[model samples]
Every structure is written in structure tokens, then in C-alpha cells.
Target: MRVRQMAAPLGAIVEDLDVRAVDASTAKELNRLFCQHHVLVFPKQQLTPDEQIAFAEHWGELIPFPYGSLPGYPNIIELRNRGKARDVNQHWHSDMTYDPTPPKLTMLYALEAPAIGGETAFANQILAYQELSAGMKKLVGSLVATHSAKDLARLYGQDPDQASEAEHPVVRTHDESGEKALYVCRAFTRQFQDWSRQESKALLDYLYEHCVRPEYQARHQWQAGDLVMWDNRCLLHYAVHDHGEDPRLIHRLQVQGTSPV
Candidate 1:
């Protein structure tokens, strides 16, 4: 397999490989590329739900999404447009951060996509953390943030009051690579631990905007045969919903991860 850089900050496109048949050596190389690049796109591939699960298993155990999953596949989440106004994925985030042990990686295989305009964008938080001013880095290093599932809970018709919440360090170190990354995001992170939202808003908003700056981001235009996966341990992603009412279907799965340090 050959790997080509997708963007300067992060992402790589793997060529000359078939997802349905990854061998042990290829799996080992893929894992190294994944930890180094944070995102990988495998184009022109057909993967059934079972095949996708098999590919994901090379990395770690699968985690069932909180809301629900595909009828027969308990670990695969089916993604589609829910209208622009109510789209839960439009905002930037790492998957399921409100859980004490959020997923370490998320994979998506497009079964159907619009002829135009359904894209996903990713931000490299490792680069975001590296570019912060020394003082800012020192401050964030000493901080912890609280993440909540209230917005998603409400969107799914569940009681927001019953949503799960968890606290994670503002700067998390990757368990495998030992690299530091900014871990807070606009979607779930409510406030710095021990600080009121009112007091934390300015700084939090600054970081929310800072982490996704164009220089640190890459975008992927979806196609029916694309299999894309990203490391949730060091990145934030946004699903663009500009395809109007056109159909877009994707099967998604997550790899279990440890609590962020």
C-alpha cells in the first residue's frame, strides 16, 4: 500500500489496497499511519457492514453508539441527513466525549452519497495544541474541562437532564504516541472544571474557534466507495450538510478507548 499526504496539517490517502482483505502486516502499517496522520481515506472500495466491522477490529474492540445502531449490526451507526436545522453533526466535535472513556477512533464507510455537497472536515488538534502561545499552553495544561451530552440527548428526544457528563484534561496525551492534543470542543465541552460557564465562555470560545483554523484542517468530499476513519484522540470533525434533501447514507463504527489523561 502507498500512502500520500492529504494536507499539510493532517490526513493521508491510502492507495493500492483493498479494505475487505487487509493482512496482518498491512494492519500493522495502517495503525502506524493512523497514529501519525490522524485521518485515513481509502477510496474506491466496497465494504459490507460485516467487512467494515472486521477492518475495525484490527485496531480494537468495537463500541456500540449510545443512541442506536443498524438493525442487524449492533456496533454500526447509520448516518443520514436529519435536515440542516436539526443536524447533530454540523457542529465540530470528537465522538462521544461525554463518556468517561470516549471512543479513540471512528470509521465511516459511505454506502450512498449525494452527487454534490456532503463533505466532512477535520481539524488536527495536535497541531492546534502545538501552535498555542507558551503561556496559553501552560494554562491549558493545568486545566480540565467538562463535557456534556445534553444537546445530543435533546436532539434524540431524550431528557437533557438525564444526559451523561464527564471531565477530561484540556490537554490530553495520546496513550500510544504520547503526543499532546487540545481535547476540548464546542459541541460537548461546557466549561473548565471549577470555573462557571459564564466565566469560561470567552476562553472556551476562543479555543473552539482556534482549534479549527483553516491551517490546521482538511476536508473530505464523500463518494459512495470511500472508507474514511479518524483518530478521535487528537482531532475534531464537522459534518457538512449542504446537500439539501439529497440522500447520504454511511455506516459508522467506533473503537473503544481509555479515559483521556
Candidate 2:
């Protein structure tokens, strides 16, 4: 299999690799590329729900998204266009960060994509942390932030009072690559631990903006046969909702991860 870099900071387009038939050695090599590049896009592939789940298990244990899952496939969920007002993922975030151990990685297999828009954008948090000033790095290294799923819970018709919430370090060490990454995101992270929202707003907003600078970002335009997987541990992603009423259907899976250090 050949892998080509897709962007400056984080993505790789993998060619000559079929997800439905990855051998042991190829799986190992794919894991290495995943750690190094943080995102992999496989084009012109077809995988059923079962096939996708089997492929995802090569990395680690599969995790069921708390919100919802596809019928007859507990580990896979469907992502489709609701409406512009109901777009829950328009902001940048790591998936399910409010869980004690968020997903290590997420995979999406597109079955339908709009003609004009509906691209997913990613930011390299590892690069974002690396480019911070020394003093800023030191400051963030000592901080922890609270992440909440209240908005998601409400949107999914669940009780907001029981939504998941957890605290994680502002800067977390990637378990596989051992690189530091800025972990705060605009969607879920509420405030630094022990700091009120009023007090944390300034610094948190600054960090939220800093983590997604264009120099550290890449965009992927979706296609019907594209399978895109990304490391949630070291990156933040935004789902662009510019497709309006156009149909976009994707099946998603996630692998369970260790708690961020």
C-alpha cells in the first residue's frame, strides 16, 4: 500500500489499500501511518456495516456512541443532514470528550455526499501545541478543563441533567505517539477546572481560536465511496453544513481509548 501526504499538518491519502481486506502486516503499517499522520483517507472503497466494524476492531475495542447507533449494529452510527439549525457538529471538537475515556479514533464511511458542499475540516492539535509560546505551553500544561455533553444530550432528546461531563488536561499526551496536543475544543469544553466560566472565557476562547489556525488544518470533501478515519486524541474536527437540504449519509464507528494523561 502507498500512502501520500494530503496536507501540510495531519492528513494522508492511502492508495492501493482495501479496508475490507487488510492483512495483519498491512494493519500494522496502517497503525503506524495513523500515529504519524493523524488522518487517513481511503478513496473508492465499499464496506458494509459489518465489514467496517471488523476493520475498526483491528485497532482496538469498539465503543458505542452514547447518542445513537444503527439498527442491528451497535457499534456503528449514522450521520446525516438534519437541518442547518439542527447541525450539532458545526463546531470543532473531539468525539465524546466528556467520557472518562473518549474515542481514540473515529471512522466514517460515506454512502452519499452532496454535489457541492459538506466537507469535514480537521485541525492538528499536536502542531497547535508545538507552535505555542513557551510560556503559554507551560501554562496550559498545568491546566485541566471540564467538558460537557449537555447540548448533545438535549439535541438527541435525552435528559440534559444526566448528560456526561468529565475533566481532562488542557494539554494531553498522545498514548500512541507520545506527543503533546492541545485538547480543549469549542463545542464541549466549558472551563478550566476550578475556574468559573466567567473567569475561563478569555483564555479558553483564545485557545479555541489558536488550535484551529489554517496552517494547522486540512479539509476533506466527501464522496460516496470515501472512507476517512482520524485520531481523535490529537485533533479537532468540524462538520461543515453548507449543503443545505442535500442528502449526506455516512456510517461512523469509534474505538475506545485510554484516559488522556
Candidate 3:
């Protein structure tokens, strides 16, 4: 397997790696590489649902989708568009932050690549946090933010006020690398733990913008047989939906993770 950093801000691509039957030593190296580079892209890894699940298990137990899941694979979800619905994944955010434990990492296997534009962008939150002003860092270091599933529920056609929520520190330390990262996202994060929405809006909006600066981001265009994975602990992703009327399908899996520290 060959690995090299991508042109973007914080991801690397690994070529000639087979995901179907990854060996122990190869898996160990992948883990270390994942810690070093928050996102890893493996082109031409066309894994089936079962094969994808097997590969995902090498890291940890998979996180099941609460609302719906794949027919036979409950832990893996399908993201397919035959051309109708508006793009729901346009924001720069972390996945499932409303859950207490959220997810350790997420992997996406591109099955049907788009003809034009279905590129996904990633932002390095560790770098975002490190670049913050000293006063801002000190201010957020001791604060916690509330993430709600209801905001996401509305987008998926569920009840808007479902009210499932979790509180996590604004500045969270990575479990694997021990680095601090900004964890608040514009999608699910509503307000700081003890602050009202009106009081927290300005700062939260500022952080949401700061975390996704172009300098800290990398973009990946879809490929028919690509497998992309990223650490949810230190990266925020933006899924662009500019490919109208084009078919796009990807199978995604998430691994269960610990609560933020």
C-alpha cells in the first residue's frame, strides 16, 4: 500500500490497499496513519456491505442509525440520490454529535460516482482550535455545548422537536492522539450549557465559521470505487451537492466512540 498527503489541508490518499481482507499489520499501520492524518482516502476499494462491515469492525463496534439502516446491514447506511431531494449535507459539521458518545470515525464507500460534482470537503478542527486567539481558547476551554438531534430530525422529515440532546465540552481532547480540537458544529449545536441561545449565538456562529476556513480544509471528488474514512473526533466535513440530475450512491459506516473529554 502507498500513502501520500493530498493537495487539500488535512487528508492523505492510500493507493493499492485492498479493504476486503486487510491484514493485522496493515490495519495497525492504517490506525497510526489515521491518527496522523485525520482523513484517509483509498481509491478503488469496492467493498460490499458485508465486506465493509468487516473492515469497519477492525476499529470498533459500528454505530447503528437510529431512524433507519440498510436492509441487511443495520450498522451501515446508504446515501443514494436518484435526483429529487435538495442537498441535506451542505453544512460543515460533525456527525451525530447529539448522541452522548457520537461516533469515533466514519467510512464511506463510493458505489455510484457522480458525473460532475458531489465533492466532500473536510476541515481540520485541531488546527482550527490551535489557531484561535488565546482569549477565545481560554474562554471556551471551560465551557460545554448542547447538541440536539431535533435539528437534524427536521431535515430527515422527523418531528422537529424530538428533543434528544447531549452536552459535550467545546474544546475536546482527542482519545487517540491527545490533541485538543474545537467540537462545536453549526448543524446540531444550539447553545453553550449554561448560556441562553441568544447569548451564545454570536460566539457559536463565529466558531462555526472559524473551524471551516479554506486553509484548514481539503476536498475530495467522488470516484466510483473509492473508500474514504475520517476521524470524527477532529474533523468537520461539508458534503457539496452541485451535481443535479446525476446519480450518486455511497455506503457509510460509523464506529462507536467514547464521550468527549
As for lDDT, the candidate ahead, 1 or 2, is: 1
lDDT of 3 by residue, 171-249 (tens): 9999989999999998788899889899899899889888988899989998999999999999999888888779889
* Runs with alpha carbons beyond 4 Å of true place in candidate 3: none
Cα lDDT tens digits for candidate 2, 1-261: 778999998899998878989978888989999999999999988899998888888999999999889999989999988455744699999999999999999999999999978999999999999999999999999999999999999888999999999999999999988999999988899999888889899999899889999999999999899999999999999999888889999999999999999
Instruction: Give residue 93's error in model 2 in angstroms.
Output: 0.4
In candidate 1, what are the lDDT values of residues 11-97, reduced to their tens digit? 999988998899888899899999999999999988889899999999989999989889999999899863556456888999999
Minimal lDDT window, size 10, model 1: 80-89
Model 3: weakest 10-residue lDDT segment is: 81-90
What Cα-based lDDT does every candidate model obtain?
0.93, 0.92, 0.88
Error of 1 at 34 (Å): 0.6
Poorly placed runs, candidate 2 (over 4 Å) = 82-86
User: Per-prediction TM-score, please?
Assistant: 0.97, 0.98, 0.96
Candidate no. 1 TM-score = 0.97
